[model samples]
Target: MVNLNAVLLISFLLFSIGVIGVLIRRNALVILMCVELMLNAANLNFIAFARHSGSVSGQAFALLLMGFAAAEVAVGLALVVALYRKRDTVQVDDINLLKG
Candidate 1:
């Protein structure tokens, strides 16, 4: 039998790790990666709930989230590239344009 509780626990742990990374990391790349991790953790929960409750809604929502994540990644990476070209670093603290 599949252990739903274990899966939920693991998902929660992954999400928490992502949260910590976003909170503590200074590199923009690491922060983006953490955001991706968070999205994946949410996806895991969606799949888990779908399996446990036998509902298609969770799966559908998960698919939507995936699509949004992909778009966000594309836009975010583009912005990162632009910032790197202008500032030559991916550190969040160094790229201060509106620091007036």
Candidate 2:
């Protein structure tokens, strides 16, 4: 059997990479992809715990989170598209309409 610690370590690594990408990247699309990566990392944890515990709650929660992630992606992409259309650029630093 694969060790739980190993699974958790991998998940942590994935999440950390996502966080670093989100913090350091300037492109909106890249940030969005990082956010998705983070969400998947969370899902991996949920599944790992569910497998370890032999219960379905964690899996159920993971499913719910997946749905939420999907909706978030849809809405986030729509907003990015709108922002690009308005500003002609997807750089996080350049499109600051909420600066006030």
Candidate 3:
């Protein structure tokens, strides 16, 4: 059986890495991917806790969160594609809110 502490540690590490990537990356696509990673990490934590507690609620919530993440990715990618077509670039720094 995997230790609960170990699972939590790994999830925390994944979350931290995702946060760093989102903060450091300038490309919109990279940022979006990092956000997804963070969401996955949270899902992992939910699953781990649910497994340890022998409850279905956390897993159910994780599934719902995944669905939301999927929708968010779809919309985010569409926006990125539209922005790329209009701006010819995906760099976050280059895109100005007022210009778009």
- The true-versus-predicted C-alpha distance at residue 60 of model 1, in Å, is 1.7
Q: Clash pairs of candidate 2? A: none
Put the candidates in TM-score order, highest first.
2, 3, 1
Clashing pairs in 1: none
Runs in model 2 lying further than 4 Å from the true structure:
none
Q: Measured by TM-score, how close is model 2 to the native structure?
A: 0.94
Best by lDDT: 2
- Give Cα-based local distance difference scores for all models: 0.94, 0.97, 0.95
Error at 54, model 1, angstroms: 0.8
TM-score list, all predictions: 0.91, 0.94, 0.92
Best-matching candidate per TM-score: 2
The per-residue C-alpha lDDT of model 1 at residue 4 equals 92
If both were scored by lDDT, which would come out higher, candidate 2 or candidate 3?
2
lDDT of 2 by residue, 38-66 (tens): 99999999999999999999999999999
Number of clashing residue pairs, candidate 3: 0
Query: What clash pairs does model 3 have?
Result: none
Superposed Cα deviation of residue 45, candidate 3 (Å) = 0.7
